[model samples]
Target: MNSGIGPMVKSQSSIPLYAIILILCLIAIIGGYFLSKKYPLNTNELKAIFEKEDGESNDITEPSGDIGNSYAAIDSSGVESGEHGHYATPLSQVNKHNIDEVFHVAGELVDYDTADQVCKQYGARLASYDELLHAYQHGAEWCNYGWSQNQTAYYPTQKKTWERLQYGKTELEKTMCGVPGLNGGRFKKNMKFNVNCFGKRPDKPDTDFVHPKLPKKPTKEQSKEELKHFDDLVVIPYNRKRWSRKDYEPHPV
Candidate 1:
């Protein structure tokens, strides 16, 4: 009973609680490294995670080079480029032959402003005097007096029909639609008349210069009202049959 050791004391853990926690964290980190090596995140996923951590927007759009080049080409084309949904023609590319091509839109005795709007609706503009003359020289024949630029009206005809002759009998009519001139006569801006439209026709045609559809014809009642302005003897047929296939109705310029 008198031994030097009194009783065996229980042994305590040599590692502290903090050191044990550190060892567990190292094991978890090593396992995660292996898992990441087996299944790595894609670029988009990584970017999303980084964006979320940085509190940045995830919406990122790359610039388009083709779209930029297309705009540049349009700028260099020397055309009236469309803006805000309004289209126009490329006048710089127009040639002499294009000047000789014209179309007509019979008005219900509309004034210059109305006539201009009608032409624009059909994707065209008022023809110039020289353009009307060139068109006349190229066998463009219309029996209706149409409003042109410079507050003038003109009608081109190859034959001296009774319809034209009736108006030619008067002194003023002779001066308006007579020989030795381009068949153009000045008029008041408020005077009602038809419309002579000139379309854009480039020397080298392309899809950029597409022709617009023709406007709808007036109804029978509308035509009757229009007929009241002109005598029956001088009424010209306002139908598609009267227009030639050669006439141009291009997009607005």
Candidate 2:
């Protein structure tokens, strides 16, 4: 029953298992080297990939310092652009008449016409009723009422809503007497109100980049000097002699 051809056929078909494994290892090494060269990985990227493979979130890792600093720089620039975020300051704190779109001019109460002219001189328009409300919501405080758009007037009070309620008045009732229950009160056109103007700050070239009006960042030495002469730097109120009140309270509508 034995056939001599059967043994010959079995011998020809047999191949070494070690040789097959060695060939496959070479192919894998060559492919991996080319892939790594084509798409290089950063430390963070590698870490993210490994973490993802391990069933963890890549967000667990914090951004590097350089990335964080870049974000900080963007935020600083956004403030100059008057973007509605952390950089927007209260109108009271705005010293420049038109530094960042919305700014106020503290002057003797002037009629609506005069306020319009004053704002015009600075290439700005009087803040509208909504604009005034926005400033109030953003924490602007001035005892002297300001001329708002559409022949209206507005001012911010330090009293919180609850405090006003305790005084038998609601904040809305106290805020906009002109609208009856809304935001602003109608005032005589001839009466004077401080002017708050809204517009874009002019852009100027800085080195190679164009930038809006920017407050200079003081150095360590400049900070010390400024702190030493803080009082000298502050301008006294124009009507301080006539208006002896240091804390200006909101007047009744």
Candidate 3:
């Protein structure tokens, strides 16, 4: 009987096929992993992760306040502090045109009429370059060397008083006073304050409720260029508002 158990000669090398298969499987797994990392399989899920992260960032969803859309300094209001102080409003936000009412506005081209209304609402006119200066200036008017403050420190806030103004003029005076004079209208609140404390409160400090600092007014020169414009239908920071001699020379428009 021929023994089938005798040493059998291997017909083919199983090592090559097995080794090649193992290598191919290892390569396939590694390649698959790398590809998955680069191009994920669950595309929607990956997209969702990115969307969630981006959506949560304030920079992405927050409105472009008076500040424009771009990296810039943040104001005390936690919005963008614009360049040249030309405020930026989000296209989606409601804006009252402030440019129109600024005794004389400068910096950016704005919807003057809308800005005018906005200013009126706040009892603030479009800040002429001079007026804007009040928000930041320290020391004497026209004293460029003097310390100036930022918006955060500029106004504590508009006063809660029935009359909220800065020039110390009564709200009635502001309403009644024609250009170049105090408001002298028939409104009871206006007429009453005009008689009682117009001169005493020549400077409006929001009735001392909100931000309480009365910024020194603009210099004379700044007043001429910035305020004179108001007399001509153009709004400007008035010169009478000037508080010091250093600001005697009118600033260039």
Candidate 4:
């Protein structure tokens, strides 16, 4: 009897080619994984791999109309505070033509109608009560009270005293006017308070800005002449006798 080694060799040779190929592939994959640990792919390498596989361009562009750096710092009620003072936000958020521009006319008391006119002169309107409250909430400084568009009077106070009755009770915070409520009620329309103004941006950029010629600033000589003229003006109800040095004398304490 022949001890048949040839029969066993023939049986192994009969195994499928695909089986051999699969076993070789598994070995290659394990070796590749270990090799990858030694030589890890970087960002550029990974990106190149993705580009090659996806067949896509690498020139990525940021989408247009994004807010980007053009942030409108105004609050919900359309108000912004700046180095100059608080100002009403422009109607258009896209173009902040005057967002930080100090456009308000304060420091002088004026009636409601006069305040309106003052704002009109500056191409603005008196800011409404809602608008003022919005500014106040956005950390606007309030001083000496002012008139709102609705012909009411108010001075901005700390957040949520009586105006924003947060806890079903009115809490007083340290502000000028003592007790708290947003509405100073309706003042006599003629009664004066400094005005806060609101302006709207033009629908488009003011390309025709040159049409309405802006006044030139006074030269040094012109300013001196004007100053001299103003100083030369005499103010009198002919009260020379009444306005004597004696009038300014302090009384005995």
In TM-score terms, candidate 3 sits at 0.18
Model 2 spans with C-alpha error above 4 angstroms: 1-99, 158-184, 200-253
Estimate candidate 2's alpha-carbon lDDT, on a 0 to 1 scale: 0.50
The backbone clash count of each candidate, in order, is 0, 3, 40, 0
In candidate 2, what are the lDDT values of residues 1-253, reduced to their tens digit?
7865555543456678999999999999999999989987688888889989999977643212111101011122122332222222333342442333444555356898788876776567887866655544544433346677888876543333323323223454343222212234888999876766666422321212122232334578866765653455755674744454655665699
- What ranking of all candidate models by lDDT puts the best one first? 1, 2, 4, 3
Worst 10 residues of 4 by lDDT: 65-74
On residues 1-253, what C-alpha lDDT tens digit does candidate 3 reach at each position? 7777888777984577888999999999999999989987887676778877887532333212221211111233321222322222222342344232111121232232343443343344334334333332211111011111111101111122112223433554333212221112222211111001000001111211112232344568866765533344755554686656666787799
| CA lDDT scores, all candidates in order | 0.55, 0.50, 0.31, 0.49
Q: Highest TM-score: which candidate?
A: 4
Q: C-alpha displacement of 150 in model 4, angstroms? A: 1.7
| Candidate No. with top lDDT | 1
Q: List runs of model 1 lying over 4 Å from the truth.
A: 1-100, 159-181, 200-253
* Pairwise lDDT winner, candidates 1 and 3: 1
Clashing pairs in 4: none
Candidate 1 structure quality by residue, lDDT tens digits, 1-253: 8688788888996999999999999999999999899998699888898998998978864311111111111111212332211122234433433232466654256888778886666457888888777665544544457888878898765433223333333465544334533566898888887777776332432433222221234578876765755355755444555554356455599
TM-score of each: 0.34, 0.33, 0.18, 0.35
lDDT of 4 by residue, 38-151 (tens): 988798978877997898877654322111111111121222222222233233422534342222345467888888876665566777777665655544434345676677
